[model samples]
Target chain A: MAEHDALTRERILEAAEDVLRRFGPQKANVVDVARALGVSHGSVYRHFASKADLREAVVRRWLEGVSAPLKAIVAEEGPAPQRLKRWLDALVTTKRSKRVSPDKELFAAYRALFDESGIAIETHVGELARQAAAIIEDGIARGEFRPVDPDETARALLDATTRFHNPAHAEEWSDPGIDASYEAVWRLVVAGLTV
Target chain B: MAEHDALTRERILEAAEDVLRRFGPQKANVVDVARALGVSHGSVYRHFASKADLREAVVRRWLEGVSAPLKAIVAEEGPAPQRLKRWLDALVTTKRSKRVSPDKELFAAYRALFDESGIAIETHVGELARQAAAIIEDGIARGEFRPVDPDETARALLDATTRFHNPAHAEEWSDPGIDASYEAVWRLVVAGLTV
Candidate 1:
């Protein structure tokens, strides 16, 4: 019964994603999701307490997908500088791809939901910062980085790179010189981190 | 007659600003602006080509107000590092003030207009980058900073500090530890700039 319930929840989330992509957040609703899944809205509510709860769950799942690869990078054994640079580059690539065609419309659909899913976003940001802090701590231990507070330095790195990954600047990501711009910022960031 | 025309244009802009502030961008229109000025909508159109033009002009005026002080900072004869730090601090303070009460409602109204005024925003951002570049060039000339490409470095600096000044991150500006966060980033930036 527990396995059946878990499968049902996964199916519901898939349906919700499709419904959101087809109709967008403004028009998408639990009824549409349930209709897509050939189930009653009541059944949808049984798995997810409310429409907002379902939307938050969908966003959380998507954020988890974004974080999974970064987690692997953090857990890998490497010189911290290379790992950190690779991590930042991967982040920029992932964010830019989401802002482009194919995923762009789906991302747009979720972005509205994101505005309402504050808890989900906060959790995602906190987790990302923690991962960055782990890298910084390792770098410090290896004498590759300055003896700065790892958490604070990690937060600073994220904030400094906000333009590269933040959705608000998504439109600017396509500019031809954007990669060079990111490189310039990365050079400065590396200089700051090195002992 | 030229002076009279200029005065009339100024009066129309003032009325337009009031109308936008009172009704917001969604509801505000040239008709409302004309009503505020006790003139026909045609009179407003005579000074401004269309609603978009009028909105762009309003945003340009506000942006000019924001840039004027920074221009003064750039023109000041001082150590480049101190001037740059002071300029960044002033920008953060100005952006924060606009996000707070009194100006906050007006800023919200204009923010919608700003979205449509891409040319105005781009020009404003370009001008700001130029101002920062001038300071960086001065620093390099004085042996205060490493010989980096001034324009590119300036752009990187702006991008790195975006969270402090960009409207999208206004909510984070009010965090109690935000100043410390900015200081941390600034220290890194200074390290990057200094030889």
Candidate 2:
């Protein structure tokens, strides 16, 4: 019964994502999700207390898809600098793909959901920062990075790359010179971290 | 007669600002601006081609108010690093003030105008980048910094500090630890430039 309940909840969330992609955050509703799942709206509510709760869960799940890979990079054994660079590269690639993907409508829907879902965003940012700090901590232990506060430095690193990954700057990401510009910034960041 | 035309144009822009402050970008119109100035909408149209043009001009003026002080800092005869820091500090202060000022309605109105006025924003960003590049060029010439591409490096510097100045991150600016975070990023930036 527990496994069945869990599977039902997962199926409901999947239907919610499909509903969001079709109708966007402003138009998507629990009823639409329920209709998509072929379940009653009350059944959907049993899994998610309210429309807002379900939307937040959908956003959380999408964000987890972004961070899960970064978490893997953080856990890898390597020089901190290389791992940091790879992690940042992965982040930029993921964000850019979301902005300019073939499924732009779906991405736009998720972007709207992301903008309104504040708690989900905060949790995602915190998790990303923790992963970055783990890499920095390892670097410090290996004497490969400057002895800075790992958590603080990790946040700084994230802030320094804001233009590349931030949704607000998504429009600028498509510029022809954006990759070169990101490389310049990356070089500067590496120097700051090392020198 | 030309002077009179210029005065009339200036008056229309001022009235437009007043209308925008009260009604916000969505509800403000040329007719409202004319009403505020005790003139016909035709008189306002004589000065601006369309409502969009007048709105763009207002946004341009507001952005100039932000960039003008930084331009002065750029023109000052000082160490490049110090000038760069001062320029960035001035920018942060101005952006923060606009975000947290008592006149939130006015700011919100202007923020909407800014978001939509693509040409105005692009021009403002370009001008600011030119000023930053000037300082970086001077730094390299004085043997105070590395011989990096001044324009590229300046762009990187601005990009790195996006969180502090970008309007999207305005909510995060009020955090108590924000200044420390800016300082930390600034230090990293300066290291990248110097070392």
Candidate 3:
């Protein structure tokens, strides 16, 4: 019974993701998710107690895409500087794809939901910053970066690259020559971080 | 008639700003502005052809408060590094005050207006970038910084410090110890810009 319930819950979440992409967050509800999964409303309720609870779970799934891959890069690497550069590129690519992806509606829905719940947003950012701090720590120990406060330097680096990574600057991401501009910013960042 | 017309137009704009702050952009129509000014809707329309024009004007006025004062600081007499630091601090201060002020509803209304019309936001950003570039050029000329591309470097500096200035990060702005984080970020920025 436990195994069956877990599978059913995962199936409902997958269906809910599909439903959210089609209808924005405001309109996507438990009923629509159940219909998509070909399950009764009572079955979805057995899995997720309320629509709010289901939306939060969907947000967690959405966040995993951005959080999981970057954490991996930070842990597995030949050199800290190389890992940091790749990490920056990964962050920019993740944000850029989400902004222009076919699931842009889903992206909007997730942003709206996350905005309503500050802890989720804070936790997501805190995780990213923590990952960044780890890379900075690696660089310092290897003598690649200056011996600055790792936490502060990580936040600075993140803020510096925000135009490429932050959702608020998403529209500017599509501008002509934005790639060159991004490279210019990246070069300055690497220069700053290097001793 | 032209002189009186100019005075009447200015009066309409002042009243429109008041109405926008009190009622927000969506509901602050020409009629409301006219009522605030004790004038007719036709009078407001005579100055602004449509509701869009009126909203755009209000956005421009809101931007001037942030842009105008800072431009003078860029031209003030001081070491380029000191000027740059002050400029960075001033931008953050302006944005923070706007976020927490009792007129925060006014701030939200302006953001909504600018978001709908990208031109307003772009113009505001372009002007600020120009000011930063000027400060960078001064730093280079004064032998205080390396021979990097001033325009590109200025952009990098602005993007790096965005957490302090951008409205999207407003929630994080209120975080405990945020000011110290901002200063730490500022130190890294100055270290990067200086020779």
Candidate 4:
């Protein structure tokens, strides 16, 4: 029974993500999500007390997916500079993907989520900053990157990459167009940090 | 008479920007703008055919303000590397002002403008591309920059700068803080384009 309940909840969350991505946060109500899932609204309500609950869940899911790859890439075997460069490319590619279908909804939904008052996005933002900072600091320590303030370097890279990740700038993204730009970003990181 | 007409147009555009920045695009109607100006809605309409027209004028005004500094920086006597760095910093600063404004309305208005259809943003984007390309080419010619495709470099720089300019990514805007991240941007630009 618990297993079935978990499956139902997962299904409902998936349906909600679809609705939020397609229609936006304002229209991603219980009725719309239920309609998308072909399930009763009660099913959604059972898993989530309200629309806000569901929205938060979706955000958590997105953060997990995005951070997973970065963590793996950092752990992979390669020179620090190469790893850093690939990481930059991966960041841009992920951001570009968010500009495409289905993910656009996630992007929009996250925008709305960020705007909600009392929502502690600081925790999430800090986590991201910490992860990025660790990578640069490690690279610097290994002599694969230039030595600079790890926190500052991490923050700069995050700002550059996150700006590219924005949906409003969606029109500007193109494949292979930003490769050199990404290289520039990695070089900047290395330059500023290199001992 | 022409001068007066031009002045009125400028006043109306300024008023529109003020209203949009204060009340957002949806609320920056002719009625509100006229009221703000202590004039009649007819006067507002005289300068602009509709709210959309007013909004366009406001955007044009904003773009002009942004471009003015860039043009000046480009024209200033300096190596391409130094001028380009300053130009990138200027671009980031201009973008940061809009993103970090306490005026939620202005931010939303900008978002609405991005959503506008049939709006010939191509001219604006093209002009930016040209100006940036010219700067890069000049740098290359002067031996201050590496020999890369100037046009491609400009497009990449503009695209990346445009990403930071977006209001949606406002959260990350100050995380690394605008100034340092921009330094990182310039470093990357120089690294990729420098001979």
Best by lDDT: 1
lDDT of 4 by residue, A51-109 (tens): 77777777767667776787787777756766776666776677678757756667767
Model 2, B1-195: lDDT tens per residue?
453365476677777777877888885678888778766778778878888888888888889889998999998997899999999999999988876656577788987887788789889989989999999999999888889889888889988999999887888898898999999899888987883
For lDDT, candidate 3 versus 4, the one ahead is 3
Best by TM-score: 1
| Model 1: CA > 4 A from native | A1-8, A26-35, A38-47, B1-9, B26-35, B38-53
Task: Report residue B30 deviation for candidate 3 (angstroms).
Answer: 4.8
Question: What is candidate 1's lDDT per residue for A101-127, written digit by digit as tens?
Answer: 777888898788888888898899899
**Which tens-of-lDDT digit does each residue in A74-101 have in candidate 2?**
9898799999999999999988886664
| lDDT of each residue in B1-195, candidate 3, tens digit only | 563366465677788778878888877678898788766688778788998888788778878889999999998997898898888889899988987778788778777777787888888888888998899898899999778888888777777777778887777788897898778767776777778
Question: Per-model C-alpha lDDT, please?
Answer: 0.86, 0.84, 0.81, 0.68
Give a tens-digit lDDT track for model 1, residues B92-163.
888888868877878898788888888898899899999999999999999999899999999999989998
> For chain B alone, what TM-score does every candidate structure achieve against the true structure?
0.94, 0.93, 0.93, 0.82
| DockQ of prediction 3 | 0.49
What overall lDDT, based on C-alpha atoms, would model 3 receive against the true structure?
A: 0.81
Where does candidate 3 clash, by residue pair? Answer: A160-B160
Superposed by TM-score, candidate 2 places the C-alpha of residue B191 at a distance from the truth, in angstroms, of 1.8
* Candidate number with the higher DockQ (1 or 4): 1
Off by over 4 Å in 3: A1-9, A26-35, A38-53, B1-9, B27-35, B39-54
Of 1 and 2, the candidate ranking higher by lDDT: 1
